[model samples]
Target: MAQVLEFKLPDLGEGLTEAEIVRWLVQVGDVVAIDQPVVEVETAKAMVEVPCPYGGVVTARFGEEGAELPVGAPLLTVAVGASAADTPGPGEVPARDGRQDPPASVNGNSRPAAADAPGGAAEGSGNVLVGYGTGTAPARRRRVRPAAPATPASSAPPARPSPVPPAPAPTVAAVPGQDASRGEGPVPVISPLVRRLARENGLDLRELHGSGPDGLILRADVEYALRAAAAQGRTAQAQAVVAAAPAVAEPQPAVPASAVAPGGTRVPLKGVRGAVADKLSRSRREIPDATCWVDADATELMRARAAMNASGGPKISLLALLARICTAALARFPELNSTVDTAAREVVRLDHVHLGFAAQTERGLVVPVVRDAHTRDAEGLTAEMARLTEAARTGTLTPAQLTGGTFTLNNYGVFGVDGSTPIINHPEAAMLGVGRIVPKPWVHEGELAVRQVVQLSLTFDHRVCDGGTAGGFLRYVADCVEQPAVLLRSL
Candidate 1:
């Protein structure tokens, strides 16, 4: 006997609620082993391959690729205790009463009815996602068939045919111009993507009739409704223009070019892009942040990097040197390396430095955190940073790698620009921005000389420290950049 088990999208951690199906690894009727990655999904944080807990034959897949499904929504169904030979062929399912029933397709994919095996127990891998674990399959409640009323033929009443034929029951699709408010209960919607589309376009879900099973609203139905509404609006506008035309012509005021132009391309802020927008927006809204900048002569820092690379060892990156300075400065000015706890009305200072650096990728801007940065030397920092940068570029960074930062070091200089007051990565107290090092005339030891100069800016949460503390931290970082020997005292 084969038992069908359902697998859902698991919690990917870090408060992520949903994910978009990127690709499916297995299809209907394919055999799978325990812990095999069944599907690849892109969450707001990163791209992840989700694994199945049961070893079985895949019976159905829930959503199509590119469809967004909430956590805990069904991802697929599997028939456990069945071999490849025992598994029914496509479009056929083993019935509960020992018969084969034709399978039905949902969203253009075949799905068989799920049922548990009688008196058969199946084991599963205990590891899935956080908060979900393996256990004995719960018994499924069976529906009891009601018995027909029994009566003697003589006692039974004879039925007569009615003069008028009976009317058909109302369907899921409501009649046009019908009052949506009059309908009872919740609207029939299963996919969150459909709801989001309707909400974004300001379309009321109640007003449109669904074309799916039992009047369930599908994505196609919502799109059709939106198109109809847009066409209706355009027609009304044309009618109004004709109605306003006058017999005696009066010159109309000139419309602005922006007003007359067609709408531009609209790129949805979602996934990584959406997450960045949300975090940056919250930082601006909640934290009272201030920025301070200073120009430092980086001739010595650059020379030190060159000297290290000249010696035969793993090449030291300029970013690693800056990160070393940041960690040392944070050690002295611990106030800048903490976060403000708004609810408790307190400033929570972190002991360890999980330093995050900004990396630009094809997807969007992502910050990958280097754990215990304070404990690592220049060489260690360089290796870890290189690994994280490669991961970010490949879109293989995990959620854990992207979060839990105490401070951020943003090297926007790679963009070839001189300086920018970077927006602080939120929840974290501060962010240090580094500009390009270029030759500039400066007073060096009482003489006007051309030296390598770089601009460094620090943006801090004002609640954590005052301007004097912020200025002191920036000055220390600048000193280290100018005279690499200044870092020796901390070491």
Candidate 2:
């Protein structure tokens, strides 16, 4: 006798309510061990692998890949008791003329053997997380069926339980090599999710040739078809726009549809992109922000970096040196190292600096925060920043690493931009932007000289500080850049 137990999606924490099924790691009839990961799901915060706590044979799976399921929704069902190889498997279910008949008992009671007894408990891992635990297992005694009346020597064995699901009869209309568009046959798709995806995208399933086993259609094939359709539609629209433009005697090639098309493709802002959009929009809607910038002579700062590298402990990066400068500046002007509590209507001044820096990756722009950055030296900051950058690039950053910043440092110089009026990272009162360091002609002690100069921009919440405090912070940062020795006073 086996007990079928249902497993639901677990609470992934961090206030996430739903997740998109990225992939399935197990299938029906596969035996799984306790704590084995069964699926990969993508939440708004990160990609996570969910582990099943039950060690049993998978009987059925509820959702398909790419389906967005809410927390606590049924994930899968597992049959517990005996292994498939040890007991009668699903394929052994008795059938006559392709029709299943209930098992007959020797006493003619027709009762299952296991149901007559009680008080047998299935063992399970004591995992206490959502959708886990041993509490759901059945408590019953396993029973054996009595000998049945002798009939033919090859008579069917006594029926235990039906392990196999009923199979749908094959359609006679649709045969191999028949065109699906003619409605002669059913579309060959295995997963219901693939059918739903094609229907939602207005795709004609018959037109697509399945690349899976036995010409079975797959989800990836449907996605590829949608992409191709979208691309072709955009190309046609672009050509029409170009042809409609008035022609001059000497005409230039018409602008692309991406540049001039009335409406272009719209990508849904979800996941990391959506999180960024919400935060930025909130920052803009709620915070009264102001920007200030100044050009600093970084020749001495460059010289200091070269000297440090020459000393050869660990090669110090320019960003680390700037971070060291930022901590010192925040120390001098503590007003910018705080957030405004809107609910309390009070300015909350933070004592420690959890500095966040903007790093761009294939996913999107992410701010990886460094804890207690004010306590770290240049070498320490360099190591931590390098680790975070690599994690961001690989899309392995946890939610904790991406949050809880008291201030932000953005190095947009890597993009070759000279200046930008940056938006303050919300909840944090200020952000420091460092632009490109280029050789520019400047007066060095009243004499014109080519110096390594960098533009520094500061955006701050006006509610927390006035123009004077913001100016003082920016000026102190600039002084440190002009002469690295200025940082030694605070250090």
Candidate 3:
């Protein structure tokens, strides 16, 4: 006989409490090796493949694809030490909740088995997740089935009727116009995606009936309801338009912006998008920010970069040169290299610089930070920036790489925009926005000439410094852009 071991969802790092099931690699009755990735999950931070620690036959899988499960929820069960006789067939799993169901041949497929096992605790890999640890497994409680109802000993048992009518299945339909989401009864939704979908479409989960077993709501049910509601809306709009028109020939009904297209795609903002939204909102709410900008002749900076590459072993990038200037500027204006501690009511000036730069990828905008950026030279900054940009593009950036910065350098110039009032990354004191360096007419040695001109904008938290300090920092950056040799003085 095989001893079934239950595995719960492991906690991913960075205080993540839940993950959406993206895909499952194994099925019931399939044998798996220890530490093999059994499922892929998407958290708020990243997509990760979760490995199972036990090498055994898969006896059950708890959640379906697209379901979001919290940490410590049962993921699957593995049957260890199984022989040919004990090997379950495809699509067959043990009964759940310690219920003593019949054999697989008699019971339906994917049924959960009793929760108890006779064998001792199973061993697992020492691989660490945030909250999960390798130690003695928790004891499983065996469920005792209630004894069959006792028959009268003094008299013969009642005879069965000619035919027994089956019990009516439970009805999930609520009274007309009754909202289930606000009711006292629990909703039968197990997936966060389903809840999000319903919420976004303004569909009340409690008012709708689920099509799955035991009144469980599935994604398909919500989609179907949305389609039906859309059709009804369109029809009502057409009727209203027809009633208002005077002529027999009907005019095309004006489309409302809120109406969903026939096959429009709706992407959920739960992962990177959600995190970005929350951060940007917090920055706007908490930071009293101000922006100061200046246009500078970048002819010298451009030439200096060309000269460095001309004589160089490792090629230098304009962004790296600008970053070098940023570090130099922050050194002079240490107030901009600090964060405000609201609880303590103090402006905390950091000694070291962890510079975050904005990078646009296919997923979204992400900031990858360079540790101790003030210590590294231009070449080192170039290499680290290249590595981080590639990692961000490939969606492989760790949370640590994405966070922890005292200042941010945003080169929105690559996007072809002249300038923007860049939002300061919250908790950080300031951000420097660089626009495109293009040819513009400027006075050179008392004569008009076309020079490489760039716009530099500084967005800083007003709470930390006044306008004079902010203007000084912007002027220093502008000076460095006009005369690259000015940066060497700080170097």
Candidate 4:
């Protein structure tokens, strides 16, 4: 006997609520091993390969590739303890009377067999995502069959429980301003993203019909309704303007057709792009920030780096040296290394520095944080940054590696640009921006000289520190650039 088990998508941590299916690794009727990678999904954070905990034959899969599924949605079903002859063929399902039948069962029961049952098929690897366990299976809901016409007592057959349970019907929540007379129940929406879209656009979910299974409202449905409504409104407004126009109006200059019907490619802000948009928007909205910049003569710093590499076992990167200087400067001006707690009305200074560096990848801009950066030396920081850069380029960074930074270092110089007032990474107090180091005319030791010059900008939250502190930090960094020995005093 085979026991059919349902496997729902587990919660990927770090406050992620949903994921878009990128690809499926297994197909129906494929025999799978425990903890095998089943599907690849892209969340707001990174690309992840989700593994199944059960070892069995895949019975069915839920969402198609490129479809977004909320957490806890069914990913697939597996039939455990089934013989090779019992497994259905690829893309085939057992049906009766031209209708699909419920899953097969074990021992006349719809639920999964106990973990200690024969063959121990119900036992799982217990390696699901955080907060999800496979120790015990959840109880199945009983399927509610429709009532049949009453028959004579002599002709009625003996009643027995169904072999497998049916999936529960979609539930809805009552929508405000809904007409009670229509007898419609609450709106059937399961995705928070769908609900947020409808709410933000003031579109009533009750007015639109869902095209998903069980009439569950999806994001596409709300988007289609909003688009149709906009087109209708535009049509009505155009008609009204034409009717109000005077019959003998003076002729006006002709407008370009391009202006009348604007056309261009529309790229959706989603996944990594969407997440970056939300964070940058929030930073601009919540932080009252200011920027200060200074030009530093970096001839000495470059020479020092060359000398170190020439004599070193492991080559030290220029970014790592700059990071070392930042940590040292923060130690002197600790106020810049803290965040503001608006709710508590306190400027909470952090005890340790988690330094984040901006790395642009094919996916988008990402900041990978290095934990306890204040404790690492230049070589260590270089190694860690290289590892993170590779991970970011390959789209394998975890959510934890992408968040929790107390300060940020953004080196836009690699782009061959000179100064920029960078927006602070929110919740953190400040960001340091470094620009290209080029040879330019400078007054050194009271004489004209050509030296390597780099521009450095510091953007700080005005609430945490005033212009005096920000200037001092930038000045210190400039001093270190001109004379690398100044950093040894702090060390």
Candidate 5:
């Protein structure tokens, strides 16, 4: 009989519960060797492809494309030991329904599902690996459209494994008129219904400002703007027409705004707004945060970064440098390198720093972690940070990458905000916000002179670190940024 094997979901590392299936590398009825990849899974951090350990005929699929499967769930079943009963060409999807019968005694080509456990895939089927999934039901299709990418720095340390999280389904924006499947002209900023309403009402939305995230013109905003414009147009036309109709030259009375009320109903905080609120609340409620900012001269650091990038042996970034410095400081003051041990009676310090860079993905804010950042110096950190950020932007980041950050860094200077005290990433103690560096008046050497200044905010948890440590750490960061050479020296 064909030896059956069940492939379970992998742990996905960093305590991930579920992952989105980005792509399927293999299909059914194809004879495969051991350790061949089956699918590419998108975790919070980076995209990882899970390899199949057994060589057998594919029989069933537990989840579909774009489906999120929980950890330890049964992913697929394989019948091993038999030669290819049938070999389907590439790109052919196999039957997800379990209906295949077991063949007569065949070699045990299937890999064990899990060590010291039951027979694979309910016995006598395809070759598959075990321990790849959770036994629970398949995860929902909810999605996370990661927000714009920026550096996310933390002020505290790391804790151990957190609880099993619900799979955050990757979300596509509520686009107008355009279906996202074809990858056509920017996912419509507005929803389909909103687009229809705007069209029926002869709306010119180009002039109105977009209040939605990513500059998307919301339905309500568009409707309101349209009605106002139409109302004004009608009133002006009436005034002119009325004035011309009467040779008496009587002044036209002003029409009230209510006349333009093409009013429609709205659902608040149920879509993207709700997601934003949840993320904001989570950031505030769970993270013990305190923000403090300082202005530092960035003329030298900017010059240094330019020179390095121009030289191009390996390109680096200002954010990368900041991440490296933060890691170094966290190393010195290990107290800041910790996670809140919610179960335990205290905060648990991390042995290594997994730095989080706040990525502004189009969907929402995704903080992808740079594991063991302390081990990587300037160049490595820069490359890794750049790679992760790019991956995050492209929606290629996996779950592991999105989780496990001891601290977070957010650089709002790119948006030209001079200064802002950022909210903390939950479970982590602190975050560092890098503001705009502009030439401003300052007393250098007791003389009033203009110097390139940058605002750095290091928000931390007061429970684990006292003002002394926090201040010192922030000063160390400021010193590093003030003098680029200092970072090289510290390294």
Candidate 6:
């Protein structure tokens, strides 16, 4: 007799609460081997592909594409013993502690699980649906970083006067007007972006003067310092980076004359795109919305990215950078980090930055949650982003990766668009839209020349986030991108 098992969505890590089905790699009735990727899922950090916990003939597809499922929700059923050599042992206990289990006895060293059994390990051990399990289940323990919002990088904007410069040499301050200290002291007001830039490039803000409004150091000043310092580090490296995504599909204009109505093929919208349409329409009508934007040039950031990759760092996408930047900006604008409390008739401000990265999958548009992005550094963020994006593309994303985001980032620059105004994910007060970076003529050292330019769009709730705060937040982000070093100070 064939034994049956139920597979449920497990925590994908970083406290993910839900995930949306991007697509199913295997169809019903397809025989699947243990650890064979069965589905692709979209989480906040990235797209992920999930392997089957139990090998068997897929008997049922319990969830639909574009559907958001909770942790432990039944996903599908598999018949473990349908074929010879696939039979389960009598009285086989479901993996009680799959996390602590060893590999199976099979020569392939697979982890074995009776696919049709109940309460199968949601995350799965090495042994699964195949007659035998292979490899150990991936480690389940996650590294926990200290809980604190990241500080914004202060370098994306044009340079301003230093409003908070330190005393030159300490000795000059005690004896005024004796040497270089004789001139008006350099302003020291540094934005989050500037502080980070200073640290990364070993720049002393006191050495360079800011010319921005109110003495705030803009990204230009940092770039200048970086140029003066690097010579080589800035130009030899450049790579593609992430930015915000724009609005929905445009209205169809006149149909092309070449194709007469033999009849337009009716493609049913399901999955990620379909889900995005449903939820975004609902949000537009039900939730009050507003937006603000600031252009950002990530030229320096692109350089930094190249340097990091060359140094054997994780391969990170531009989406990861926007997520990290927004995580930092949220700390200075916490009101945007909130949810609408239907039961309380008030907004609940979230202490942690549960960030959502909007991803497109065959199923539809889904926003996956990254529990606390502020806690992760660039390397960690890069790794998680890869994992999530892979899961999304492969149809194995877990349900928990889809829920509870305090803010969302929609990046479209991957396709090479310049900019767009993205909608806010409901309940959260704001969303960030990033666009492609292109070369533009900009003034450097008081001379006009080509530099990288990009645009940013910020949509926020009118009730909670005001224009000034939202605008300031965008400015903060812009400053960081233009001057990648600002991240050092914020950390």
Task: Say which candidate scores most in lDDT.
Answer: 1
Off by over 4 Å in 6: 1-266, 362-364
Give the residue spans of candidate 1 off by over 4 A.
Answer: 88-186, 190-263
Q: Report the C-alpha lDDT of model 3 over 69-181, residue by residue, as the tens digit.
A: 66766667677777434655543332335433321210111112222222211111111111111121222333222222222332212121223562221222324344433
Question: Per model, how many backbone clashes are there?
Answer: 0, 3, 7, 0, 75, 100
Off by over 4 Å in 2: 1-7, 26-36, 54-59, 77-263
* Best-to-worst ranking by lDDT: 1, 4, 3, 2, 5, 6
The C-alpha stretches of model 3 lying farther than 4 A from their native spots are 1-7, 23-38, 51-65, 75-90, 94-188, 191-213, 217-266
lDDT of 2 at 321: 89
Tens digits of per-residue lDDT for model 5 on 1-491? 56668777778776555566667776655677789888887654456779888888765554455544556656666667755554222233333343322211112112222222121222211122222222211112112233422222221111112245522211222333333332322222333345557568765333333444323456546655554455555556666777788654533334434334545555444322343466669867766667677788877788888998898688887888888889878877888878677677688888988888877777566778898888887799888988888887786676666776888888888889888877777778888889888899988878998888999888888777887888888899998887877776666
User: Per-residue lDDT tens digits of candidate 1, residues 1-491?
Assistant: 87778897888999998887888898767899999999988888988889999999876566666656678766777789887677655545344443333333323222222333222111111111111112222222222222222333422222212335622212222333354442443454545667789889987666654544334566656765665555545555655666797453433323333335456665766678888999999999998999999999999999999999999899999999999999999999999999988889999989999999999999889999999999999999999999999999988899999999999999999998888887889899999999998999999999999999999999999999999999999999999999999999978
Output the lDDT of residue 460, model 4: 97
lDDT of each: 0.73, 0.69, 0.70, 0.72, 0.61, 0.59
Cα shift from native, residue 63, model 6 (Å)? 13
Let me know the TM-score candidate 5 reaches against the reference structure.
Answer: 0.54
Q: What residue runs in model 5 are displaced by over 4 Å at the alpha carbon? A: 1-4, 29-31, 43-46, 81-283, 307-312, 331-334, 342-344, 347-351, 362-364, 390-402, 439-451, 485-491
Cα displacement (Å) at residue 376, model 3? 1.1
Instruction: Find the 10 residues in a row with the least total lDDT in model 3.
Output: 123-132
lDDT of 6 by residue, 1-491 (tens): 67677566767785555566767787656689998888776654346777778987765444445544545555666777685234322223324344443332222112222333222222222111122222211222221211212222321221223336622211101122323421343333322334567668766654554444222345555665555334323222211111122333322223223234544676633334555666678778766887777766677888877787788745766677777788888887888888777677787888998888876776456676777888987677777877777676665566567766788888777768867767677767788888778898877669988888888888888777678888888888888898877766777
CA RMSD per model (angstroms): 12.4, 16.5, 12.5, 12.3, 18.9, 31.4
Indicate the TM-score of model 2.
0.63
Question: lDDT score, residue 193, model 3?
Answer: 58
Which residue pairs in candidate 4 collide? none
What is the lDDT for 414 in model 6? 70
